[model samples]
Target: MSRFVRQSYYRHVYGQPSKREMCFDNIKVSASAWDTNLAAANPKFLSVNYQASGGGAFLVVPLTHTGKLPDLYPLCRAHTAPVLDTSFSPFSDTLIASSGEDGKIVLTHIDEDRLTAALRLEKPEVNDLEPVLRLSGHVRKAGHVKWHPVAENVLASTSLEVKIWDVEKAACVVELPQQPDMVGSMSFNWTGTLLATTCKDKKLRIYDLRSGELTSMADSHTGIKGSRVEWMGRLDRICTTGFSKFSDRQVFVWNSGDISKGPIKQLTIDTSSGTLMPFWSDNDILFLAGKGDGNVRYYEYEADELHYLTEYKSSEPQRGMCWLPRRALNTQDCEIARAYKVTNNLVEPISFIVPRKSDSFQADIYPPALSGKPALSSSDFFAGKTAEPILVSLDNLSETAAPPIKSSLYASTPVVPGSGAVSPALPPSEPPAPRSISRAPSPVSTKHDPLPSSSPAIEQPPVSHQPPPSSIVAPSVDAHPEQRSSSSSADVDQLTKENQELKDELAEKDCVIRNLELQLEKFKTNQMKIIELSKNSLN
Candidate 1:
């Protein structure tokens, strides 16, 4: 008998000398939640969040580079309560939205010029950062936020309910009630029109923005704790990771069109102690699940079945993890995937790459994608006065225009002020037959759980421990971008040559490994053939 297991890779750890010494020494990251990101990425900067004492304010530190960690200061401070989550605007690099325990979702614009002016004056007391707009829709602490992939000024945040807001107008375009339950996690489909979320009630709810309908609600993991959902690229399907009724962790694939059919396929991972945080690769065929054990497992999905490919193992478990957006990947180096893993004192960048011999740039692998500029401004979005979103796909990313969305629901009905009620703007097309919607019972409590207990919190359970006393929040002083001090050009040339030689040697080794694998498969085929022939002769 023979067995095949997953291949593992090496992780290049970053973030040294502790986050305290670097601009966030005075701030303490909240231990009560894990929704806040330790690190996030954009072309201009990498944003890091640190919690303030007593849920009053938080600092967002922006690093100018990748790979190496420097002793840099935070770029700005912009939250009143402990920020639960922060996300970059899909259309703009300077604008970002944050959800806080103070029940406010704020939009902040980072002015590089403002930061630079303060640095020039060496004024640590300069705190000019404030939310351009404060949205108060959630009754409790706002938990999670995500921007629309293609639409302009379309963003969603979760609390006891879900609110879709347009920063341009400083208004909520759509508010989704959680049916008296709390949402665990939510993900948008490829076209940015459909959303899939897991609720604390153990139900998978699908929301279609075009139709303004709940679409479908089906039974999910049935476990008591965590669940996360992700769309399978262009495929009208979603993959979810959660615990089963028996507390065994599992991953399942469902047909988004007809979730009533339930999961088409299910793969049980393990009965580990920690909940899994699932991240789908940019291409959408590969999925990685990072857990508390410091091991990140990767699998390839095809036709609803998952093939275990590899795992990124580490000695230290990750407290938080976030993958760089597709555009941030270095395709020229054949670097397919990268993630920032946040620990207690340091954050590291983990790379997942394909073993290839080619060193040339591949445009096909780096296809045209979304830009930071939105088609419509905030005023234009509100002037249109429609909850119906303009949908776009990856294939048409370069079109540079948002097609006009025509929906009678938004134009004809004037919304009642401060009321969470609006006309349903679903399916601008034909109507479909109504179907029955049911909810799954809570697996943990007998209270007929309406998703009120906990959040998926992602990656690790809501962190219960804060940073040590050694770290202290202090007034931020700007430090210049950390650059490697240049040495003599001759030494640099020698190093470059040596690096190229090492890459060539690696390519050769990869070639040899491929040949050996091919031979192994051939030998296995021959062995099977010989056994079959001998059995026939005996018969």
Candidate 2:
């Protein structure tokens, strides 16, 4: 008999879909043919691509405002064409960016107070929300917009080329080399140093943002449909979702260290016509929500293999889907992640929870999550400073502490702490190395340090017309020559520590390989027994 042991704490996690009255109804989701997620959400608001007659617009609803929406509600109408994609800033609840067919990106600031008041009215008056800033540079229709995970007020928009913008200064800081074809999706690594993009060319490209250089490009899924790429945090890998040559949905895991060699592992999901949108709940759990499908399948990535977890199925098909930030998760209910599914006229919230009897905080399931606070300013990041994300404790984050949504719509209200409430601190050990890119001959050099314990209080300049520097340079050393000896000794000690860490990782991998071999042997023994039994029965 084959004896298999399951050893994951999150293996029992299941999804709980919100009821009809709890979900936002009467939403006019966009009918655009663009293969993009039309919805984006944070702790405070949910922005959905709105279907309108003229010009592009998206509805920004307060999280608290649930149930049937008013017929004539306000919308963020800043684009003259149909909007393709929208992304909420990781560092701010009120700030969001939207890209449209107008070849422009609009940065909108949600007036929570004003929007809440309008939603409360029996006969809501018509009001058009305006954007705070507009970025116009892409000559073609911008299909996607993503905010930097670890930087404040920094956004990336994809058209013919990828443009990195400083939202505060209204400037394009870095424009990556143009893609061979239309970009389907883009994902930034943990430290915001490398960018992974999937294009219509059926290829994946990783860009080294520091030098504005193309790191590695590899053939991805071969199907004609769109593909999406996501950087798996801390794992030093990239997971891409697309279709196989036979049009079967497939997931590929590629080594970030060297993507040119191709994906390390590939698996075929069922033949679903809809594109699979991949989202990482944490570093381990991956949620795959297929557009036009009602089921969302999740998997746990471990030992270089994606272990199948469980699937959440619903009868209502989703046109688009978006995930809520980790900081906004309801820890009291053992909720691991939350995804908002956009149906025809409704936006539903699906909470992935781990069933637990205790009311205490589950620290094993909830590690330190990446806080909304940025690791470094845009200026400091561009100046060659590499830092890990500032992590925060989820222990104090309770359902009662969630952001107050004032609408009469639902039962339990969730709250998000203000940005100022975040503690700027780094973990004890150095986090995984920031994804570094390499050219043919020389590899990209990156200095890894746990992020600063405290955020710098420097303010960014209003205007920045200069293009991004060609290369990132380290900070200047002190002129005092007497400190050289001490610096050399410190470097030696750090190198020794890193070497030991590498050795420990290698040993752990070896142990995993042995365990897998033993399991394979047991499976073979079980197969033999079944074959012998069948032969005896035939005789």
Candidate 3:
């Protein structure tokens, strides 16, 4: 085999699975079949969705309480149905939220002292803990819940519609425009100002959170299975993972500033049946974990391409997985990131560690991380105040929080409360059915209004053409009135009609070209799959 050589700092990184004694075992994982991790983790606690009988419940296990948990233990139970998703508050170690099939979101504050006392007992009772706050607004079952990256007491949950909630007020502050299809996945940018979402309708949409306007959108993968999206940290980039028409897993990286022009780069992985869940690290590393596969593929994303580094292979496959926050990583061990993989009855921690001979902290691998502090309060955030997250150095444990690093990568554009930069009234068009499951091209179209002229431009030309000449220029003030008016109304109408026709032609061609590009990509992917299969057979 011929291979090109390249040097990378993370080229030799490896995953170290937790020992049996350290793993959380004997817990019933949720079987709701939702496209969620079924787990949420922080430095202090790990929350796992529990398969309860009477109501939806999740267990919050402290990091020190690792072992084979009892058959019945304390659970944060309040929901009337199975819990679909759970997320820990970024600013609070004891605060966690859960969304349930009963269309409710509950916030529970875990009492560490009570939990500690229970863990010390020889036989702990099955204690049922209730939530401190209950939010009921979604008409349909809520599928996902997430906390704002840079704001305190601000949360987001998705159902038929995505709602931004102000936890302090216990109310839904911003109800985003309804989604066309069920949202498969959504992610907030680093600044928490813009949100990127992938929907079942096979479209990737970006929304300005402040105004609740759909800014730009594009066609995504064609497979009917779920898709996932993630915003690259501190960069104006978004990455999505989904299945192609032929069931091959594919990854796409888009310029967050302009999605109308389509993905800047794309690549197809293997023909895996499981969805690839994407995770982004502060070091620009992208980790792809297959839903059903034990192996995790990690890459360094630079220069608009994903450079393959290595893969972590294991014998036991994972049902779901979640990454720990960057601030929680062990800098002494040169741990760049850590992921918790939930198997049938155990949740194991896998730490991605970089090999080093020295015991000192590796500054290159460990950058200043988010200090788990909110930059803006709920009121300030909704009042149009914007601020970046506070960062702290990993080298010093007790040092003061570092000042927020300012970067020119993304501007804090003030979101107008009621601006229609991109029309939110676009009809929800169904994606065209696949011609055949094998190798046929899927006719996917993005039915979104054109982005405002002030938006960033992509490499490709805009879909809509320039306005007619008459609209671009005004009649000279010194021109003779009769001469200026000499052009008959019929002639002006003819010019307008021609301009419209030309614009339509250009748009049609642009759509055709994009479809052709997609087809070509599919063909290439198919060829590569065949070659790989052949090589395996020969070997």
Candidate 4:
């Protein structure tokens, strides 16, 4: 019976397994542009657009679960042009802001049950919800629209120029003039104390929010320049990227203290034929750079150095990147979640795991004894009858097995004078013996045997060793005047050489200017002759 029971247990432990199941499904939707922008209201809610089979565009999926994106419920559909940017208000999860090429900015709320009911009931007749506000002041296509970080009712719109709107009053609060060309991007500092604007003119302008004054500016990349600027949340810095004329795409970190100064640090990559889109995380330590090459790169910022963390790839080019506010450290499972616009009409949101914790198999493992635990316990040896007894034998044991004496190497010892004790030795017996001296050989006579004395005797030198006064005076008289004149002459020669070079350069410039002047004069003479001939013909 026992053997049968053991066999049954083995069978139960090694039984055939059931097929695995997936938690989420791959959601497909139609977008207008090759890529669509994705925004999440919360961990459980996300929003995306879908191309209507009939025509135009619509905000189809209002709030879909992060785990699974079900069929979209058509909520709002009023724009004729493709939506360029969409953003959820940071202050309220229910409210969202969207701007399209139609130059309209619509603010709407997501009805929770209406969305779920429409999906459950398979109702295709979801109503067009009324927008809380419709902003309509942009002259050209509205490129981007963003809600103010600290202001609940303030929104910013960017096109050729930047305009701030007071939503409650439905009035433009301020109009920022464009710098000669179009404005590519704009962002407000974390505290909403400063505003940063990037232009197609290859310049970044910073404005003081309180005073509404232009504070500073920096030169940006000259080609494929960055259309976005993000101020580091907790740092006095800003990050931007664009393609350079040098055929290299670069991202720069500029210091807020001195904007006129060049970039504090920069990262360059050969995109070959792609573009780079960068986004800043909540804490700013992690920066997400998405390339058109279908790869997203993660970088850790330490001071001015950007350390490469890892890279994730997608089959399609990523159009937008955002860091969702994770609920907790454990819940923050991914570094960055991206949205890829695969086709001109389809957008797929993909999230890759950042893997904050390493896999156990790759880490070092230790035996039970070495795994941070006590090897043995005193109770094991002193337990009752249930414990095994330890045997003691006298036959082979050493009689004088002095309770294993520990070496004094690690033990402390007291000092004993004159015995080279543990303590440092006393100062040497006396001041070190004085060094001995040696006598010089005489010039007039041969050297004689030197005495082996303990110390050398002191003596004074003869006066004949000193130089005569007349010899010294004669040398000074011969050299002083010539030395002074030569020093002056060398200085004159250096000045002459510098002056000659300047004169030669000036002469060449003059020659070129004369040739230009002569050409101008001849052209003027021919123009006068033509004017005189025309006058004669008219008369």
- For model 1, how does the per-residue alpha-carbon lDDT over 1-539 read when each residue is reduced to its tens digit? 55964332212222222233332222234454553344566655445566333244444444542233322233334455767777877656777777777677766667666555434444232334444445666778887888876456677898777777654334466666555566778898755667898877888989865445788989989888768888765556688889988889988888887898899788888888566777876443355545567887777554455767656676788666777766566665556667766666456666666555577665434434444544444333333323222222333334333322223212222222221122333335322221111222101111211222222221111222334443333545536323222323445566667766765674465445434644775698899999999999999
Tens-digit lDDT string for candidate 3 (1-94): 6597676779999999999999999888988899999899998999899876667888888988888986546777778899999998888887
Residue 180 miss distance in model 1 (angstroms): 3.3
Best by lDDT: 3
Residue 57 accuracy (lDDT) in model 1: 44
lDDT rank order:
3, 2, 1, 4
Local accuracy of candidate 2 as per-residue lDDT tens digits, 302-359: 6667889889998889899999888889989999999999988899999999999899
Please provide TM-scores, in order, for all candidate models, with all chains considered together: 0.64, 0.74, 0.74, 0.56
Please give the lDDT score for candidate 4: 0.49
TM-score of 1: 0.64
Error of 3 at 46 (Å): 0.3
Question: What is the descending TM-score order?
Answer: 3, 2, 1, 4
lDDT of 3 at 491: 62
What's the lDDT for residue 197 in model 1?
87
| Segments of candidate 4 deviating more than 4 angstroms | 1-41, 52-72, 327-539
Q: Which ten residues in a row are the worst by lDDT in model 1? A: 440-449
